[model samples]
Target: MRSALIVWGGWNGHDPEECAAIYRRWLHEDGYSVRVETDLQVFADPAIHELSLIIPIYTMSKIDKEPLANLVKAIESGVGLAGHHGGMSDAFRDAVDYQFVVGGQWVAHPGNIIDYTVDVTKPEDPIMQGIPASFPYTSEQYYMHMDPSVEVLATTTFSGQHAAWTKGVVMPVVWKRLYGAGKVFHSTLGHQAKEFENPQMATILRRGINWAARAEA
Candidate 1:
């Protein structure tokens, strides 16, 4: 059986613990041996080396270098990595090396706390396959610092609320990237637990995990 290691908890405001529970249950139903941890040491375990995937639900903290490096090496060797919102993007903000390896960093959400539409850019991708072509929801409209090579699967257009260089910009909301032999999938929409509970959102998450974990095949 494929194993999954979920490291959660950094900023409680994003409800990483709650998000971990939701993911744990979903993945368990899918038949993965899952473990939820708040400690970064979980990354260093040789057992983790055999796992099929690693999902980080952490936001904004420096994970100790040794273990963090261990995880990076694991990902580089083809273990799957997947996450959403600031949990993955804002995580390890001070660790430039980690950010570089992860492929993107959360810079700003220009039009904060507003309703916006999320459009599927590559609807044919496995992650977006079952989702509606377009959908609307009330949440933060993210403006990210992204990697140019990312395969954009979904995006949200921003009609800026206040004057800034990003005013009237169309930005990627969800994307995937290949890091060495591994795969990384990210979504900027999971700022709240309710967001993940959306039917389309859940389906996308499931498919994304499967796609990211595809290397095991």
Candidate 2:
């Protein structure tokens, strides 16, 4: 069976433990052998190199050089990496290498738990199949500094309602990229675990995880 590692813990606001549980259940249902950890030390374990996927739910946490290097090397060696929201993008604020792998970083959420719409820009992509072309969400509308090489699957437009300078600016909501041989996937949704209850968000997240885990195979 395919193995997956979910390393969670950082800021409690993101409910790292709760979010990890939700994904753990889903990964189990998908026939994966899921190993869950709250410590970053797991990244240094030799077995980490054998996993098929890595899901980092940590938010705004510090990672030591040894473990962070191991994690980076593993991903570069083709193990998949996938995450969402501040957990992945906003993690390890001082670590440029981490942000480089993620392809984006959460800079601001202008409205902060307000209503916004996500536009599906690539409905033909398998990760977005069956999701509506557009959908409404009442959450943090993330304004991220993204890497241009990512394959954007979904996007959102800023109304400048909260931040006038950003009005009419289109931002990527969901994207996938490659870090070395690893597949990297990210979504700016899921401020909380409950947000996954939305069918569209849930579908895209699951598909993204599956796609990332498969890597180039």
User: Largest TM-score belongs to which candidate?
Assistant: 2
Error of 2 at 204 (Å): 0.4
Q: What's the true lDDT of residue 79 in model 2?
A: 92
Q: Which stretches in model 1 have alpha-carbon errors above 4 Å?
A: 214-217
| Candidate No. with top lDDT | 2
Models, CA RMSD each: 1.5, 1.3
Per residue, candidate 2 scores C-alpha lDDT tens digits across 1-217 of 8889999999999889999998899899998999999999889887787888999999998999989999999899889999889999999999998888999999999869999999999999999988999999988999999899999999999999999999999999999998998999999999998898998888999989989995322
- Model 1 lDDT per residue over 1-217, tens place: 8778899988887889999998898789888888889998888776666678889999997788788888888888888899888888889888887776667888887556788889999978767886889998677777778788988998887765543666668788888888888888888877888788777767777778767874442
TM-score of each: 0.94, 0.97
Model 2 misplaced regions, further than 4 Å: 215-217
